[model samples]
Target: MAAGAPRIFVSHLAGVAVFDPNGDQVARVRDLVVMLRVGRRPPRLLGLVAEVATRRRIFLPMTRVTGIQSGQVLTTGVLNVRRFEQRPTERLVFGELLDRRVTLTETGEEVTVLDLSVQQLPARRDWEIDRVFVRKGRGGAFRRSKGETLTVEWSAVTGFSLEEHGQGAENLLATFEQLRPADLANVLHHLSAKRRAEVAAALDDDRLADVLEELPEDDQIEILGKLAEERAADVLEAMDPDDAADLLGELPEQDKERLLSLMKPADAADMRRLMAYEEHTAGGLMTTEPIVLRPDATVADALARIRNPDLSPAHAAQIYVCRPPDETPTGKYLGTVHFQRLLRDPPYTLVGSIIDDDLQPLAPDAALPVVAGFFATYDMVAAPVVDESGSLLGAVTVDDVLDHMLPDDWRETEYDLDGTDDGTDGTADDRRDGTADEGTDERADDGTDGEVRADGA
Candidate 1:
């Protein structure tokens, strides 16, 4: 058992009805939720949610629950769980902690909260929370607030329940709904390659696409390498077609063809056409998902078209200004204005004038280095990709490039090769000179011994 955790059987609490301070019966113990942590897995409690029949299912922070004997939790008092509401920022399992303060080491001008330490206290027969104590970097002595204490206000303490001592891929899998894809991607970066693959395999296709979009190109390739071809293809298909096309383009030529073949015909055709252009220029980085309106369409019609469920945000960056169907192949790019810009302007205002001529557009054959540099030069989150005819092709986003180039591990490496008896170091001679060490393999290169010879007779 963990030093501080108590193991109580669930059978004890099954029949007991829970009550508030007023003695009104709430919900009965329906189930016990226990994650295997360290030693002796103890069962934890998960209260039911509030509904019309149950009225309100309030949370009981672990702190207020004084003891867990038999199966029932012994409370400090008959207080209604409702009285103590969970702060929005509080972590689950851990109690409410919002503005709690802690002293942390001040290396230079910056300050940080020290992480919690897990250790056993022999005298108390329980675990002690050893927090890191820190202050300003200046030496000597500093002014004290109530005589120098490293304590944090109880309010700032959020969830600290280590579901398990070891890393939990399943926990991460279960909490998929609670985190952003970018945060999941960041967490995945810390895991081993195999562990990361497991996490990827566990997610649904839509979620996998989201997480993939957040990962760097190298990490994307690595995770994809570990997955079954069918699974990988399914996830790619779930992604925005243009995003999928961009990622597929980054794959090795052989992999690119294999994956493309596995994709649906429509998706495959879109990717194939996108692949035909140079990668760095507008052709290579542009997304084919764009919302274009026929020049003759009314603003109401355009708004109606935009409301269609089939169109995604990626395809509908406001509306792409285009010429009528009868117009020549070259046509014209009247102007590109955002949805907000159009909505705010007078209804009669032509989109051409409203469109920002300062719009950044790139050619398909343009080099990627140049394109990347242009994104930096312009500080643009998105840039348009176009063909020689000035028709819109696709758009590239800064997130895609970030996922391409960001580093995985950010910690500094510590290496020390001090003393050794290996031949690489001269210390081997000193250790062997005085006496032969038992079990040492002392053998000559030519033979075990020069004196040992065979006679032919």
Candidate 2:
């Protein structure tokens, strides 16, 4: 649903048909999975438990859902066929919350939950339970017997959140909800193997995909191996194509093939194409998804695309002007329009008119040193990689180049907020190197530069 759309009551969604982009019915929603917070904070609406034609229930993550309107749920056409398993952190809205008694903070009167309303947070994809529909007197959801009924803000009720003493991965995650993916990856790296797996399993696919991209190669392989193959594929699909390809390339041939087969054909093809390149080449380092504008696109169009919150700073630094086919391996390489140039132009000015074609584009097979040199010489955060045929392939971001150049264990190193080394050796082999006890905190010193540092524990 779009941000600021009308709230959807949970009761209305029961058994609603779910369709793919093609409008073919895929399943019917059986329940909604939510995670309760620590206080009266509204619970996050996770996703849906949907039943297919086979009567088997599966988990449909919200990230895959594109629309929920006209009594139908729309999906991205990518579904993980594995049966849904309830995690410790999840609560079924229909199964566990309805008809339950919760006390109102004002009157100290108990009310029975009849229905709940969920609203998508503005400017973000996350949805949360925002209002409670309840009866003032005792009555079951089916029973007509009831006193005054009314809808109240979620914070008016007092029985939903987890207990203060509760011990679980969910609590740990909530406590560190603000941590960057790299910092969280560091915490997970120092955790016991069992704890790491538990936390990984509890995280939603999108968040897990982000954290996995920052984790060490061994950690990434181990965590991916432990997940169900169907879910592994889903997480892989959620990741950036280049990172996904790199991870898949590390797997055994049979295992890699199996995961690739489970993914959507288009995504799988991107993986295959990326994996075909040498690990350190431009083709391997470049992200298939970038802001590609056609020759006729206006500065307004390019600016709007660059404004997408999902785009990394590096990717948004410029727009690649191409031919008719705008997708990567586009019709023909035109020229680039830097972000600064877009700002200087009129809103309706054509991007193609002001393109900077003086600098040559990097070749797909450009070596790591050559690619790095291009960035250093031009002082560019990103550069386009074009094939010999003059078709725009993809753009190599400087961060990816740095990730490849850094020591294999650089992610494991510990540095203080002031950019100085701590007294202890910067290694994670001990599994307790820089944790809460050491008063250490990790922060992204420079997100575009891919620099992270510890903040005095």
* Top TM-score prediction, candidate number: 2
- TM per candidate comes to 0.48, 0.58
lDDT of each residue in 14-52, candidate 1, tens digit only: 334554433444334322222212222221222221111
Model 2 lowest lDDT segment of ten: 442-451
Q: Stretches of candidate 2 above 4 Å error?
A: 1-168, 415-421, 425-457
Cα error, candidate 2, residue 377 (Å): 0.5
Q: Cα RMSD to native, each candidate?
A: 23.5, 18.0
Best by lDDT: 2
On the 0 to 100 scale, the lDDT of residue 397 in model 2 is 98
Q: How many steric clashes between backbone atoms does each model show?
A: 14, 4
Model 1: lDDT equals: 0.47
**What TM-score does structure 1 among the candidates reach?**
0.48
The residue-level lDDT of candidate 1 at 275 comes to: 72
